[model samples]
Target: MSTLDTSALVIGVDFGTDSCRSLIVDTITGEQVASAVEFYPRWKAGMYCDPDRNVFRQHPQDYIDAFTLAVRNALAGVSDEVRANVRAMSIDTTGSTSVAVDRAGTPLALTEPFRDNPNAMFVLWKDHTAVREADEINTLARNWGGVDFTRYVGGVYSAEWFWANMLHVLRVDPAVRASVYSWVEHCDWMPALLTGTTAPDVMKRSRCAAGHKAMWHESFDGLPGEAFLVRLDPLLAGMRERLYRDTYTADTAAGTLTPQWADTLGLTTDVVVGVGAFDAHMGAVGAGIRPYSLVKVMGTSTCDILMAPAAEVDGRIVKGICGQVEGSVISGMTGMEAGQSAFGDVYAWFRQLLAWPLALLGDTPDAQSQRDGILHRILPELERQAALESPVDTGMVAIDWLNGRRTPFADQTLRGALFGLTLGSDAPKIYRALIEATAFGARAIVERFREEGIRIDEVIAVGGVAKKSPLNMQIVANVFGLDIRVAKSDQAVALGAAMFAAVAAGLHDSVESAQRHMGSGFETTYTPDPEATAIYDRLYRQYREYGALIERLSAAEAHPAPHSTELCTPN
Candidate 1:
């Protein structure tokens, strides 16, 4: 590693599903000097969402407000000199969280008439309300006698992506369709917003978000052509023109911060804003990702990122995973993505299920306190008990498709299932099964990569679940029959953004150099237990069998065989 610049500082802001986190880091040592988090006020209040319908929307103002507060608060903990030395900033966000915008790139939700309209707000990445639209896209891409836009994206278009969500909104809302000028991903928009270059054509789009979600590949000559989009839906007729033709890697600087934003954030106008990308991509970099090393961002949902030299991937496509985009992670490497749609979220769902009685306990202060206490303890206690359960003896098996499958094929229509449950089944037993199921889901992704000739030499884990949950980590390691290393930084996602900022600010020659100087080493490693791995190998076979059966059943239910009255009598 080269000598680092101790005087330089960079800020990395991470926008998650519920909150934004800001971290100030020293460019020389990668020490997290100060950090703060602020929840989106409107999202925290559960506004513009319908859980049952799988429709989730976030107002743009919430992002702006939360980011502002988080940065200001994080900066408050540091000295005047440290704050003044801030050279550049970068951001990562959950995607394909996107919103409709006017020509100037202002989100529709910020306008007067669309202030409260969910359709005008950002459609969150987990929102699956656009299933029909996604299906339409898949069907069109496969049969439309044009370029298969989804070929690089696992040959499936997902509801939890950009075009499907945009199409869904355009088809349902006439006012929005007529007035909207373009759409913007949350990751791309923030840097543009800070730089005051919000115009759809002028803003630098993220290669990661565009390639993974919107099917924007260099071979396509930009986004899917107007004819293909129009054939999918008339509402998308002119959208191709409205969007941009080029996308940028995160190492590039979008622009310097505008005076207005600089004043708002208590920073200088010279501060550079690096182009943003999806959280998991940057998080992988932050965790010290290397070629063929899978970095799993284990969070509410998971986004597993892998990188390889261009020569290794070279025109070969891996089916049933997320998109394989060149330079999405490192400038010259192939960044491949795959993930489980629900990881930690599955645990949270069970916790909520177990705490149902708390709803009836009333909203008084004491009752609320009791409810909070119990809720907080539920997961830890479950983890403890689940750890004690015999992994081989637990007959229960679960499908971690509660939020649908995101990898080994992206199918948002699939629902979760539990098998082998009996009268003797208890909460801890069930919880153990759920944890095993998630691990199995992860293993399936790893298997797919290997099956497709992509080598995974090691696994590095980052994010909340990786840092907090040893039980889950051990299960995952056992299921994979491989050792798993957890990254030391708690805010690896933000750290990644800062690394990119360092490059964009000219503090480092390349991402690799910045990482060499700034990267935090692994905190611990989880080695697979031989006995547990042997047992899981058997259970994994059973899990696959059950999953295949469930998928067949689901397909039959969706498209049943027609009845033949005459045939029944003959039989």
Candidate 2:
């Protein structure tokens, strides 16, 4: 019913940690035609999370509601003919975040009494409530004679990942656990739901999600053996059987859009739906990731993506990273992921901490307006003031672990610390230290890859921090001692998904071809300052020593003995 032409469009849906965005892009020139974003209402209201406990969840209805709104709004002004010619749709979502589903493929939170329960909802990517479960996995995997499941995932299992979250939920909520038929990642579910393949046992799983977060690797043949899972927990005995063994790449089509969804979004049912992936992985493709090129998606959190030729990597397992998977970013290359648990989040936390005094004087309307104005100007003003002081002027250093360490080893038990605070240290002085801390966290990830023989020739940055925060960008450039190129597209993650959609719809032969024509390219480069780089190099050593000291103290506190050598002895 629709004609294929240069004017055809493909849509990319990016379901982020806080919002869902729908982007319509022209197939010919990769120009963005229209886009709309809608934040999760309940999530924005903070209805389902206890930040103090590190518990974060989002109701399934919020995702459904936001997606429908975003798509409809994005397509509002387009002509009917233009809508009919849309070739395909693709999706990307925050990783490791999953929801428990019923036999009918309905998320538990969408049905019955569970509708009001937070545990029945989607666990967010940053949720670290399963720290104990993750520790158990690491210990058991190390002792088990089977293939090391943690090897591909940086020799460490994380509370922020799949199995730990599943195991923890099963232990905590017996009602939901009994009702849940299986689990599905947010990335995989969006595409499956669009194509009407929401079957618990048969929905398409993503190689990106499975390989990076669920310990799925070619070496294990599929997921870890049932015997190994049973050893971990009897409840997990049959989960592996329920989950699909075959995972597809983003270039593959999930299926055609269902008529029900098609009508709602004013699209033709013929539009194909491509397989889904994590946001950062798709973002790397959007940023034009080539072999040895590192792409960092910097936002509330940071997800660092790098790809290399499979032959060049030599199958070496990089320690202390998120994971390394073949075809995760590009079809023929090995994609490696690493990240900081908090980046912009550190600045946000500081703002909240500073708001206490303002909160006490907020009853009057004038006071409220003043509070609002302060929030608006805080970050930019901090950057302005902070520029006046040198890194050594403050003699202060901070750790960006308020949300825990996500890479170079995943440890949720760690908390942030700041040293050298003095009466002379003002708000801007402390803010500078926080920014520097996040930069250091990123540097650790890059260094880890190189230490493991993975080359990084160029660095590309995409996302809010990269685009809007000049201070952060320059600091990152200096910290890594490398030139940082910021992507031109503000919506690179969504654009990357659109590229996959183009391939799935046959507009392009592969993702690479689509990228060649559709990529937004780099807009600006921030080269490291020789003077600043040298100063950061010295501060980095101190940061490492401080991190080690904190770990020692935490270990001693956790296991107090008359004399403990755990900190002193090497693992």
Give per-residue CA lDDT, model 2, range 1-571, as digits (tens): 2223676799999999899999999877888988999999999999999999999999889999999999999998688777777889999999899988888788899998798888899999999999999999999999988778999999999999999999999999999888988999998888889999999666889999999999998879889889989999998978888887889999999999899999888887899999999999999999999889999999999999999888777658899999999989988888999999999899989888877688877589998999998888888888899878889898998988899999989998998899889988899999999999999989989889888878899999999999988888999999999999999999999999999999888888877788887888889999999999999999999999898878877777776665654454223
True-vs-predicted CA distance for residue 126, candidate 1, Å: 0.2
Tens-digit lDDT track of model 1 for 1-571 = 4435779999999999889999999998888899999999999999999999998999999999999999999999988999999999999999999999998999999999999999999999999999999999999999999899998898888889999999999989999998899999999899999999999989999999999999988889978988998889887887888898999999999999999998998999999999999999999999999999999999999999999998879879999988999989999999999998899999999999999999899999999999999999999999999899987667888999999899989888888989998998999999999999999999999999999999999999999999999999999999999999999999999999999999998999899998988899899999999999999999999889888877876777676667832222111
With a 3 Å backbone cut-off (N, CA, C), the pairs that clash in candidate 1 are none
lDDT of each: 0.93, 0.90
**Residue-pair clashes per candidate:** 0, 0
Worst 10 residues of 2 by lDDT: 562-571
Candidate 1: list runs displaced more than 4 Å: 1-4, 564-571
**The best candidate in terms of lDDT:** 1
